[model samples]
Target: MDAVRPLPDFLVKRYQGWKATTYADNRGWYKRLAEEGQRPRAMVISCCDSRVHVTSIFGADQGEFFIHRNIANLVPPYEPDGDHHGTSAAIEYAVTSLRVGHLIVLGHSGCGGVEGCYQMCEGRAPHLEEKTSFVGRWMDILRPGYERLAAGNEADRMRALEKASVMVSLENLLTFPFVTKAVEDGLLTLHGLWTHIGEGGLETYDPAAGGFVAV
Candidate 1:
């Protein structure tokens, strides 16, 4: 704890400015949110990449989305072994307790985690193959998707794997009993989204079309 340093002046200054403006403009909204607690309608599973901003992209307000971010925006199959499961815990809380109506798995271009999986599966990243690497282990959840796309062009395969990561997460979400029940009862809906970082183009998955379409 002692090793922690104070925040930079630029961050502090910007935060002060933002805080002042936010309170000055939406004082009542802030008060209501603080007093009533959050009732988010959607739970967003997104990447840890700083470039993918859920709020900014969706123009969301505070307390609108319950968000969880991890490497590759991946979700593993439901494993109730009683060990630490951050993402699973978040999903459970969102679905069972918060009763969020929508669960979104968001993927994006040039994902380092997906790229790492591509390298690891291709026998290039030895560190990731090791038992000690956390990122390697996390990206392992996307390996099946990578394998499924192995027959295509290398570049296209990587992009396919990135999109498939969202598919994988969506499939795994159904493995949870509570999630399955909620979804079956029409209490929850799932969505998949992929974005182009540079161009800001977004594509949504269409089950009928079996691919992403411009949204």
Candidate 2:
């Protein structure tokens, strides 16, 4: 694999400038927050795409959200298999430890991870062996959704696959004991959300309606 280098010169210099400006604008607020620790109301699981930044998308400031990211914004089915359960550990901390009031699984259109699922379903990506591709394993949770949504036109099928993927992930969330307990006790709620990156629209999943509606 090729070694990744630092950010481009322009981005590095621009971020340096922004850092100083932010410090000047919120020095006192930052210090107070650092001392007090965080009490964010929500936890968000989103994609690791460079274009999909949680704080910027929500206009959140420091200490607003406890966020986690994975390919395709997926949450694996609860399996305490090994030491490298990064996403699971984050979910445990955010829900059980932090006691966040809401946990949102944020999925988006034009997601590369979701697209990868499409390729796998069609047998297009030969390099994706079941054991090696973490993407393959993580995304397997969405396979049933893809199968159910397989009847429509190519465009419609993609849309269905994307939306169904979110629903499947929501189901996976309930498999986690802490998340299930939180829901049962009425202390926490889970939501599935879809974002239209191209047009900047937010559609939330509605189980009763069986669709994504504007929220």
Q: What are the Cα lDDT values of the candidates?
A: 0.95, 0.85
lDDT of 1 by residue, 1-215 (tens): 99999999999999999889977799899999999999999999999999999999999999999999999999999999999999999999999999999999999999999999999999999999999999999988988897788586889988998899999999999999999999999999999999999999999999999999999
Q: Assess candidate 2 and give its TM-score to the true structure.
A: 0.91
Report the C-alpha lDDT of model 2 over 1-215, residue by residue, as the tens digit.
37888789999998889878987799898898899988899999998887777887789998889999888877878998876888889999999889999999888888887888888888887655477887787777778878887576777888777777778888888999989999999999999998888888889988798889998
Per-model TM against the reference:
0.98, 0.91
- In model 2, the worst 10-residue window by lDDT is 125-134
Residue 100 lDDT, candidate 1, scale 0-100:
100
Candidate 1 TM-score versus the reference: 0.98
Pull out the clashing pairs in model 2. Answer: none
Best by TM-score: 1
